[model samples]
Target: MAGFVNVRRDVDDKFYRYRMPILLTKIEGKGNGIKTVVPNMADVARALSRPPTYPTKFFGSELGAQTSVDEKNDRYIVNGAHDATRLRELLDAFIDKFVLCGSCKNPETDLILTKNEMIVRDCKACGERTNVDMRHRLSTYIIKNPPPKKGKKSKGGHAEAPSPPNKINGENGDPDGEENGAGSDDELTRRIKAEAAELNADTALAKEDWSADTSPEAVERRARALQSGIASLAVSNNGGDDDSDEDADSPYSQLGRWLQENPGSSAIDVFKKVQELGIEKKHKAVQVLAQGVFTEDVVAEIPKYVAIFAKMVTSEKHQKALLGGIERLAGLDYPDLVPSIPKILMQFYQADVLEEEVVKTWGTHVSKKYVDKETSKRVRKASEPFLKVTEHFRCTGNRAN
Candidate 1:
């Protein structure tokens, strides 16, 4: 464990085969120009079978800072000065979410974007296909920039591991020694070189020298932190259900009755009634209007109400509530159309009922705030395909310009 650590630091097995280099970070520049650079990001990314940009971008997203990727130079930077320990903790968070298999907790997973646009982690170790939580901001990044499809095949027909020509340390994969001052033979530089060399080495010794920490309390602490992070995604509620009670006096009921009374009412008429009822500012009004205004053909009917939705969705909270409305519309009211969520979302986006950032945020994680846990999950899972394709188009469009 001199230059490497167990992939699953919680598993205290002395013989754990999966290992990766210790994360090394260097703080560069001063004041407003300060940044944290990971010189050995390529080596660590290789060990995880992911693009170096992923963890770099994840760090930026979590820190609310900008990130820069220098694949050609083997340098990844996150703007603003940060401590190495903080970055290491964030790296652990990344590994738990993206790298380790959800079933086996091993770093032997392949990210596959499905036809429906959902990202699945296909674990080679456990034979399990687990869906990645798309609610994370990093999911958009992964969708935009997928990992290289497959490794190159060697002469023997086996796919050789990727060997990037440039390493932070000048020896093994390093092309130029001057970048990051990696050419100097200082103790830290030598250690980084050794770790980089170990990444490319396929010898049996490298596989055997892995260690883990088995302390139950330590493992529990890490698990609690991760759980807390996931729990934070959900908004606070008084434990009331999303749907309001139906009564003759209820504003939602009044609106529903008005909709039923005026079958041919236009979006403007609906807006007038919504304002008259004093429920236009309520988030749940979006849900009520979605159910009341649309029929069995919700997808076809969505275009008719885009103007109303635009007027109603005046804030981020309203946008989220609109998504919640769709969850209930498709998930509870018309379960049959749950499969058509991507189409539904596309229509919403095209109609300006939803913004790209809001949809991306909603798609990343499933929350009980919108509906019942199972129903919300079903809705978000169905929407993944659309989210993926949307991100892909945005990325390609940027490059085309």
Candidate 2:
């Protein structure tokens, strides 16, 4: 029989049993003999005794048994039935070592073997999900391969020689020699000189344009454009016709002529004329007055208009325009106007309807202007009551801070 044999012998009055097999019976469905017979040892032994020949193999191993090391390597190589069993354990170890959450960089994640035929990992920190199969392949490659070590320097104060660059494209010179060069040094120097000359010409032209003179005719035309609507007014009879005509025809010429013709006229007279203009015409008059104020020609008259805007203004549109004018005045760095800021802020506070965004906007403006620590603290504290009132009315989106 192509099977096993048993030999019984006595040595020194002690009997010994030796069992051997030539062929084993293959199980019905399982491929190999011993594995098909029975999985457990006692059942395998029972199956072996009842078979035509006693099978010496265990779990399909020709040596009758497999060592733990051989089985592990075989499991790695086969990669089908036995390998599937060990894959999860290997994946768990890889995830613990390498994988991190994409959002929070946390490694605390759970592996969920999804039914959609994919391995997915869920991050506990930031609730991000990642593909485990991709991460696994990347992790395995990283684990198997390591980075190259840097070379150590040579002794005797000499550094290790750098590796020669590889030649490409059939270059004639050494591969590293001027590989990045685009042109010769003489070509670059010529290009730089040409660019510098172009820039110098442009700068000289700009200076000449800026220094060009504004003729008296251009000044007269600008004044006539400003006085287009007021040209029909009857000339005042209190002055010489030539000078009065000049004053009546041009606003700016009138101001200049007044300064020269009636040097004794007080600033209050000029201010009174400005205030007498209709409200619709006041903006242009105010702009002209602002120009005069900026030039220190009519600075004494500015305080009257400032007082008028502060007290006489009731309409919100006019108040806003007045505030803009005050902001312009503040930009002039006039020390005399500094004390009026707190009064202006108080007026804005009284006039505004305590709307949340409005209060916050004004509050921010106040904070920017009031640099004194105590004054800033007081202004911020004063704003809190209004902010709270706005919140009580369900205006929560406005942020004052």
Candidate 3:
């Protein structure tokens, strides 16, 4: 019989798709020297998309015992008499903290160490990059032994696949099992020359784009070549995925385009158009609507959009989604929008859209979806006013208990 279960599902879930092998622990030794051996740690770690040594080290750190992972024998051992039940409980904590994404609770995430040495999780499913909690001892270990760097993907979809090596049997034989090798030799030489010519042409074009001659004629030629290359590369990168832009066909993109096209459109008119066009998700619409509606006087207009925000954050799920979008929309793009975000958030508080729990969740991490690192930092800095409101509620014992 199979002996595995989904890490975060009910123990009785019969058809849960996400499964990891059961923690098979064998307690060995007696009296003063006791240890638990996890014989299938490598398999478990493979399923969890983590290095086996991480969990091994985590167990030692948590249990206040020594642990070792013997790669040669595929053995993971922790000193002490631990049971499957305790280890399973520990696994839940690990999954919650390190495995699942904070936004979507999906396990499809990669642990990234940024240039600032901050540990973060990049959720592949939702495109949310969240900073990891750094208070735990395991966090220290993770920082020291960070995951390997992932290759950069082309904007199309995934990283470029390497060109396959050409197969040649110059010394031994021909693929057709020919009795004579004379004809095959001539064919191979012709093929090599054609391939070399193609490579030379590509090199010449790339070199032309990089030419830095300062003469007037040469400068014009260089500019034309550079422009052509950039245009081609941009088209290649954007061909596969629907990268966001002002011209995209998505409802959010249409809203942004319409806003830029019709700056004088009334709020009622904008809302009507949004309804007629049909927004797929209100959370995403928040970002588009913010970008389209607000200008230098965003603070004065916060009340105008209060009804929209109220509808967006009506439930806990909506609150998380809307906050994620807000982290991007109110991010750092609008210097005008930045100064007013704190007051906008306070309105959320007064409207009960941003409850105390939601506010606490927003402060948990820096989001990197709609904004860059520095921009996100600025947005969070501008949000200090909302923090005071939440703190006031917390200090006065008005937290949602």
Candidate 4:
């Protein structure tokens, strides 16, 4: 059996967070009728979060071949004797342009049809939104037959929704009619509802604290971490007093608090505030600024802050502080998004907020200065795929020299 492969085969295969089945192609109907049947197209499409027809039509668009979709039968066909490797390569191209987020490179995205008939990729991973290239022929097909709207409730409401008739009278006018097995279905539904009610009545699980620590003390600790952590790291890096007491109204703390309070502030507004605080000259301020400015949507927000960061992160040490801030943000605040650290780092690097050498150097070692040791290690492990690529290129360049 052909096991699964990473959705982006270009990325490290060991990374199993995003994966899809290997393309399996079988040639059938020899001669002009010959076609390649993708038996597992539905599975692969499901993994990529795309309709099977999109990739099926994509294959036809790229190969200049006729394609057929048997959605009811889970069959997708592309005319001609094409090999699996060729189809897989084309699929990767499709994934890059259509599936992955243009900013973060994460594949957890959806194709949304706009009122103007354009399609946009809405990334769930980092909340990045970008327009799909309409130049491709598949775009026309996708626009015409867009993906179905998910999780939409009917305006009629649940009570107004149609259900099968409870009974259908036979020649004998029987009240317990078995038409379409309605009687058995009703019994099964009653059993399920009773079980669900019992589960809902279990108050212990519901009362348990399943969410993050939002108690007053926990909140105060988090506030302190935000206010003091970055400055301590920066001071420690500079061979200064790491144990020095910082007031609640210190410049860095003020910047962090302001960013937390007014997250929707524009880059120009934030830069203006930074100037007002007279902290623009302090590169260490970049650390606290980054930690406060971004939330779960850090990847998407990077582009909008490029101008401000270009001013703040002027040197390697500043870039390191930026990375440290991101570590705290992802590791401590948003642990669920830790797997996206590589994409987040890439977004920063692409925006010129962090230097490539600085990212490579930071990824090499896990430091507890920004976050706890375990979290720092986890973040670095998540980043290994990106780090390894940069290391490979550096080593190759050295060999060529």
Candidate 5:
């Protein structure tokens, strides 16, 4: 009859032991699923047709043992003390089929029984050491088991995998639903090209046949189409109205002609046209016309015009035109320019103006805005400590005194 032992190593490097007998019996419907089961000494000895032995040894030694047999279950329990080498060999054999590191999945490892009451194993791959625990070993064994075979496809053919849960909006719909915000760059480009094609067809039809001096209905239809073309171009360029030098006969020229003819048109109409023109073209036109013709009447009607221009400066597309406009006004000392200065300075202070070129340009205009002596002095003082630190470290030798 085979025997089993339960052994524990104590802090004093001594082994405490208990013993039992191994039993074998056919468990109906539990063939391959049989797991190692521990039984008490009395039951184990009874199963083994042997008398129970509590705190008994195979021979006479400090090593301890206990034995039991269970006739009813046909099982036995054997426990005993073991030396480090013997315990290691038993543990290695018991855990041989499942000793992989859970985290790193390293199979090759050295078993280390420590004096500090830890059975540690070091993984060769990831250099991670883990304690040998029964729970961990059992879990690793279950994880290593192969998955069950999948069933065959149905007669209707293989069903599609269910769509993953939608993170945004959480609507239970097809993943290929309507796209939000700006569509993909390729899709946008395709749409723009298609729209441009339609616009070109309409423009060609108008030029070859219908004249603006013809019927009022025809003229109105043409104007509407032209307006749409301009709007489409403006949105495509992100409100940039500047035309490149390469395109000699640009859309802006057509829009500009329409604007000049319809001088009494609404601000919204003008704004739409302005949005259509390339950004540089819009700025150039606005700068020239605003100063010359924006007159007292126009300024009163659109008090927000200067404010809009100041806001436009924040945009990358219009930054150069905006900075140039500011510099020109600062040099000419334009009367209406003072009110826009505070808004510009606040923006400049907030923006990432770190580069030397940007700083130099900003420094020239910044001093002009700081007119209040006390406020200017306080601002300088606040920055002095940081300046001093930089100077001390020789990062920038010049510091505000």
Candidate 6:
């Protein structure tokens, strides 16, 4: 009776520890009004570190039905008859899309709303913040009803000082636990009357309740709150207003996007663009350019950017950056690029771009910047052909010396 199962589909292997409560389905009603209910959705969502509404909304989206959550009662229902298996399958999709970070594939992440309202995932496991795909239907719902922000951890692991006290209570003349005379007493009376009027609305009481202010400032405050919430929702449903804003903001990213878009563009053109952008001529920056520019078809297109690579590896300082960037550009599951890497290094050698020692050391342990540790190891494993070529050159050169 472990009562928990791993979130991932590792049924064949029972050693997984990332566990969550097994989905429980409770079918209710009948005919057209029938629905599937999940009693433990709140618990399951807590295990996933997400709001219950997110998975509930996802169920609605996946099943092509309406969904509702009675938060006070912890009841989640979908307007269809869904079995535990189907719900679990849909839950996996939600976890993959929202919970898991695209870079590290870990669930320890915080979904952040940027100033411009774009949703990005900040990976706790990896210090990387990447943009969330704005195309999902649940993106809007998540934004509108974002889960409460987790507080900073203190040494004792408790939440950062509890959230501010209620505004009504704090507005007293003696907020620091002491009482004031008529001013404090009058404010308390108004606050209480306002709460009662809100709960039991009567036209007579609403008019009498002085705390339910109809002033311009109060109206403006409410309007602004509504607008801010609407803006957040709009951002969730729609993508960024300007896609090129990031490009314009960062020259490094600008060059990357430009290079990726125009593969046939010349090295002279790239160098000129780099100069125009006021980018530093540091080899490290060039390595960044190499990473940003060439993302796909790099094996075939590597030859075209020979001049760019040549400039990048001109000095000893650029050697490590260029090699590390190369590892990242074609690190894993790219068999075609493995052999080409040796030939590419040879071409760089013939052009005097990379010194023989640098090429020899290229066989050393892989760079872990681009890919994860395990993937970096596999990438180096795939680079055996290139390593052998470099070793042959080293032996031949030694014989000549």
- By lDDT, who's the top model here? 4
Candidate 1: residue 86 lDDT (0-100): 85
Per-model TM-score on C-alpha atoms: 0.41, 0.20, 0.37, 0.41, 0.21, 0.38
User: Compared with the true structure, what per-residue lDDT tens digits does model 6 show for residues 1-401?
Assistant: 22788876644457765678888998888765678899988888877777788789888766645577787788899876778888999898988888888897777777775544446888989978887755455764444334456776422222223212221111112222122111122322332333334434456523442332336675454344323222221111121123232243555555555654454455456666775765433444555554544433454344455545543343455665566556555553233455466655555544334555664565566654546677567655665665565444332222110
Residue lDDT tens for model 2, 1-401: 34333311112222323332322222332232112222222222222221111111111121112112122121111111222223223323332333444455455544332322233456766798775432222321211111111244322112223222221111122231223112222322332233234434456433443221236664444344324312322223332122332364455345433433333233445544433332212223332333232221123233223322322232332333333333334333233444445443433332221123444555455432313344444444444554454343232212222
Q: Candidate 5: lDDT over CA atoms?
A: 0.32
lDDT against the true structure, each candidate: 0.63, 0.31, 0.56, 0.65, 0.32, 0.55
What's model 2's overall lDDT?
Answer: 0.31
Q: Model 6 lDDT vs. the true structure?
A: 0.55
Model 5 spans > 4 angstroms off: 1-266, 275-303, 306-314, 326-401
**lDDT of predicted model 1:** 0.63
- The 10 consecutive residues of candidate 6 with the worst lDDT sum are 232-241
Q: Runs in model 2 with CA error above 4 Å? A: 1-271, 275-307, 310-314, 335-340, 347-401
What's model 4's lDDT at 300? 57
Writing each residue's lDDT as its tens digit, candidate 4 over 1-401 gives 77899998988859559999999999988755678999999889878877788899888767655578877688899877888999999999999989999999999988876544457999998998898876565764564345645554322111112222321112122221212211222322332233334434357544544344546776565556555544454334362313222666777767777875565576667877886876664555777777777655566566456556644554566677778778878877667778888777766653435555678778878887777789888987788876665444332222100
lDDT of 5 by residue, 211-242 (tens): 12435664454345333322322112334444
Residue 101 lDDT, candidate 4, scale 0-100: 94
Q: List ranges where model 4 is wrong by over 4 Å.
A: 1-245, 391-401
lDDT for residue 191 in candidate 1, whole number 0-100: 26
Please write out the lDDT profile of model 1 over residues 209-305, one tens digit for every residue. Answer: 3333336664444344323322222333342334344344667667766665455465666777886886665655776676556644666556456
Better of 2 and 6 by TM-score: 6
Instruction: Give residue 328's lDDT in candidate 6 (0 to 100).
Output: 54
Which predicted model would earn the best TM-score? 1
Position 343, candidate 2: lDDT? 43
